[model samples]
Target: MDRPLRLIYCVFGLVTFCQASIIPCKDDDTKCLVSTANDIYPKIMSGDASIGAEILDPVWIDEIDGSVTILKYKFERCTVAGYKKCNITSLRIDAHNSKLKLNLMCPEVNLSGFYDINGRLIILPVQGNGNFSIDAYSYNINIDATYKIVKTDDRKEYITIKNFNFDANAEKGAKFQFDNLFNGRKDLADSVLKFANENSKEVLQEFQRPILSITYKIFIKNIYKFLKAMPMDNIFKQIYPKLHSFTCVRASLTPPTPCKADDTNCMMTIGKSVYKQVLTGDKSIGAERLEPMKFDEIDGGLTMLKFKMTDTTISGYEKCDMKDLKHDNAKMSFAMKITCPHLEVVGTYDMDGRLIVLPVQGKGKFSIIMDSYDLSLTVTYKIVKDDGGKEHLSIKTYQAEAEPIKGVKYEFQNLFNGKQDLANSVHKFANENWKEVTLQFQGPIIAATFKKLIKNTNKFLKAMPMDKVFL
Candidate 1:
């Protein structure tokens, strides 16, 4: 749906919520713009989805001289979904005819966005009946009306009605649909992957940077201009960027337990709001020593990261949910064991800084060092999807020596061992299978999409937080 951006313009301040938003109604009831409650009772019992009803009209007594003028009366269901994942893919060997079940849920889901501070923001994850209530795919949506423009006189305050949750069942449903159709044919891999894209979209964990950086850069660049014009700090105040959901938690290859079904080494899960501390560094400094995930997958969760090439290697397991983005960000224990001293992490990453974000879009930028100087990589994210699904972040690094003052040439041991390095293999594959590696996004689209993805990450970053996100 191509919709224009319309906003409820006003100053930001504490506004009391009115009673018009608290009335309960069926999912299919409608038609309450006017008329008495008894007059609308017949329509309410008729099971109509179009007839509107005013939920706030009962207690909403506003006389024109000594009354309330309600403006911008609106309603919507709010939802919230988690926005973090791992850099690995579940390498599950499905049993023949096995029915796979993934009833995952987003941190937030299906909720309201446009709302009134006066009305009640009733939220329902999914429309259902009772204790055994299951979501009725075919149901109606009802809302109370009183803050309409016809009643507006002076109040401009408003509340937001929104829902942003990751629907795990919906996501798993998509995967299952395809699993049922697959007959174990390699030729069908494309279709399966395509389906994954159509349903789950980008698999990378840092799909918010591009949007954040662009927006942040724009803000910094224009803040002086705005400050030159306006004086109030509130004028410059914007929605602060927040680190939402993170579910990339993967299991450890070797933890305190056997790591099987009974393993108790999983990450300790957080219930509600969690305050996690993280450290910040640059390409010059990296984790000199790192190990695999400290616990099991069931413990809590892993931070989903699609690192390009960092100078440092944090030990952890690679989750399977992050296998789609073309540029493999996997930190396989084997790979880390091999390229320990050769890589570099360059660029900027969110080490935890509060930022003002826009309502619809924002971005964040991050850079990391491998361990020593040399390996440098930048992770970026934005508020929109422009990059197809791949990143051109790979930079070829060759061990070079510094110039000697005299005739002596300093020599250092080559960290790389094999002539046929994985870097070379990856390059070869890209050159040959560029179509598959890059997919439909081409080069331009790739930049457009990811420019916003990685930026919105790291808001809730933790220090050396559970490294096992390799997929």
Candidate 2:
């Protein structure tokens, strides 16, 4: 019996001894991040496939207030065929029990179009409150226009609006009034002009602006719908593999440029907004800095507005400091910096949902060197297989090895469970067995605290619903 216990202990002890022989290789910060990210990618992707399939991802009409709902969308990375890359990251809605369930797995691309890759769709659980603007715009536009669109929809050849068609009138005075206004009397024109001059602002205000009300009857094509209507030939052939620059405000547009390999011109995205192809100047590998502005408060806190480049992810907002574009063909100047924030809750394929983004390193690198080895317990977590058919997220406990780094022969301690026995296996191995793994970094630490990079990354992932594991 002692032999058996000795043998079992020997097996465990010898393994621990082997672990003590770790010889590390030095690597830079990028390598450190890539290694860590690659190490976790499989788990993240698997979770996306399994857990994301279970959540809800749609919004329905019956859930609206007074048969209507209004929404306001701030624009971000778009410049492709006049579309902005935006993901609906949050919904501030006001209604009675108004819940907008956005399918996070929805096939959407950066203001360009959607593909099946990002996930089936994202379904969101909306909380808090604000009136939706979709209904309000619809209401305002439907009323108060002499040329209000009767059939603004495209199924017909022309936009039929409520026109003031003088041609349709048979009244004798109407024709005389037209002749007087157009050809006959300068005095009559001056009198009418004076009346308009007095009331013009009010008329324009009524036509230009109305009560921002919500209406149910109007159905205008939204940006997403408009993009979806592009012929597949157009989307895949003309749009894909090309890059564009867009301004989130006004009529800023950058035409698509051909994409090349080897440069940062590789596939990159702004938030959930996708764009491809970029011109690499004489230098082929530097990513253009993206300078999209970011807000400190709000869900889905980042926006992207630059075109694609080689190895960098940049965000941009129009330079408040620069002069405006002078002409149509002029190359608009933009200022870019590293940007785009991950969203918390609220899901839709807007700029915030774009997958390939530049990563942030917080303080970049930090360190934690121990003169003695002590395995920490309590604050540990491990990837676990749960009953939801998806992986179970479980707590792991670590016990310090209990020996000083200098004096005694060192040993390794593990925090793992038998049932949730993954032990970082899938990340380290194809099979379920864990491997003798090692890591190297540009320095011993990353970000301000040695643990901060990982901590911030985890915070980003954790803020997202379990279904939305990073893509």
**Residues 1-471, model 2: lDDT tens digits:** 121121211111211111221122222223432333333222211111101110011111212121112211221211121011112222121112221111111122111111111111012111112221111111111112121112224432212123211101111111101113324356744554354334543322321111112111111112112222222221111111211322110012232232222223222222112111111111122322123212222122212211111121212222111111111111111112222122111111111122122111111111112222221111223333435555322222111111122221111112132222432332233111111111111011111111322232233323222232212
Q: Using alpha carbons, what is the TM-score of model 1?
A: 0.15
In order, candidate lDDTs are: 0.20, 0.20
- TM per candidate comes to 0.15, 0.15
**Alpha-carbon RMSD of each model:** 28.8, 31.6
Instruction: Residues 1-471, candidate 1: write the lDDT tens digits.
Output: 000001011000111001111123222222221111323222222211111111110111111121113211222121111211111111111123221111112232221122222211121011111111011111111221111111123433222212111222233222212221223354553554454345432221111122223222322222222122222222222333332222232121132221222111221121011101111212222211112211111110101111121122223111101111112222100000111232222222221111111011111322211222111122221122125542211111111111111121111111123234532543344344433322211122122112221221222221113322211
lDDT of candidate model 1 versus the reference? 0.20
**lDDT value, residue 152 of candidate 2:** 26
